[model samples]
Target: MKRTEVSFDIETIPLTIRQFINGATIYDSSCSEHAKTLFVSGSERAFLKISKRGTLEREYHMTKFLHQHNVAPNAIAYESDLDYDYLFTEAVSGEDGTAELHLENPRKLACVFGEYLKMLHSLPIEGCPYGNRTHELLNDAQINGIDLNMLNEFSYSAIDNVVIHGDYCLPNIIMDHFSFKGFIDLGYGGVGDRHYDIYWGIWTLNYNLKTDTYRDIFLDAYGRSNIDDDGLNYFTKLNKLTD
Candidate 1:
């Protein structure tokens, strides 16, 4: 693999740390092409993620906060330069849900996701902070001149809000031998409508497995006797427009 040299202004660098950065393997794991994640293995494995300056603090603070809640990795190192932000965190040790072991048994894997997600959503939101509301996100997108083109506002009064993994897809979830470990790519996570997560989870399964065969099974496993078709369709359309 070709290495992308990431340069920053530093007052000093010890020889050992400089060499470690050079030897680390850059991972092409993120679905977002703009952000870069590198996996470094030594005494312990850690992941270093770098992204543009705009999201520097939001991701750093959220990941750190989630770690405090024991649902994500500890934020081991963090720094920001004029152009980019760097965050190093302990790796969530596991194979992702896409691993063939899980793929061979899709129903079981979906059950794992279902149960784990239920636990995540139940985390108390009282004093827990730092999440972007869906309304605010849509407003920000419109302000930036994105073509929303007649998306109707959904009633918050009707929808139940829960802690959501803003991008709750298979790849972002880590699994160890079909057992749930933890979550990754939590930059968009926070209190939001349950449908936001359900939409993405189903979409991700459809996307990765190259079929929609398992969508209903996933919902059943997640313990919903009836599907929320209205909520799912609304959020899916909204996401496509804003995304």
Candidate 2:
């Protein structure tokens, strides 16, 4: 109820959309402390997210960019009104990677997760607006009320950057049966170091599966040669400050 008050004031939604969603089955799908996400199902399937004003601007733009690349959902609308930001998007058709089917087969799940991450990293960053994530991450960590000493001060200048799903966790990955459908919850996605994504990919698998058994399998599937142990470790430390 507090989330409804703080993030989503139902009256803030446009009238036509509000009427439709009021009649549809609405499910609370929030996963972060910063926002509220709702899944609406009925005549049309869609997701509506609300957060503090101006907070969803980047997600709106990033989703639009990735949609052009065929890897994200189409962003339908974005509006900032009455101290809240609202974003509407058509839903990607599939269950997330954490679904029982994917969870039952760890080996297959790890492979698909690794392979698809590799594919996302291979995307061209030519028109990406969020290419300065490394610099931004450092700055964000320093001033975001987190202890600066907790962050790794490693120089990432020499590493090649790629289009990364900033939050490359299993829940953000959608799978239709065993195949990768698309990605969701891409608020932090953009051009960044590959190891950052790899770090999350490995972490998510271990966290979701409740074991570290698939770490090497995931790395190998993502092309072991491209992985840098030091980079992954650096990101592991850096993530604490951001999280």
Candidate that scores best on lDDT: 2
Model 2: lDDT to the true structure = 0.81
* lDDT score at residue 109, model 2, on the 0-100 scale: 93
lDDT of 2 by residue, 59-163 (tens): 888889888999889988887777888888888888899889889999999988999999999889999978877767767776877665543365444243798
Q: How many residue pairs clash (N, CA or C atoms closer than 3 angstroms) in each of the candidate models, in the order given?
A: 0, 0
Residue 98 lDDT, candidate 1, scale 0-100? 80
CA RMSD per model (angstroms): 4.2, 3.9
Q: Considering summed lDDT, which 10 consecutive residues are worst modelled in model 1? A: 8-17
Please give the distance, in angstroms, between residue 172's alpha carbon in candidate 1 and its true position after superposition: 0.4
Taking all chains together, each candidate's TM-score versus the true structure is 0.81, 0.87
lDDT of each: 0.69, 0.81
What value does the lDDT take at residue 238 in candidate 1? 73
Give stretches of model 2 more than 4 Å off.
1-10, 15-22, 144-160, 241-243
Clashing pairs in 2: none
TM-score of 2: 0.87
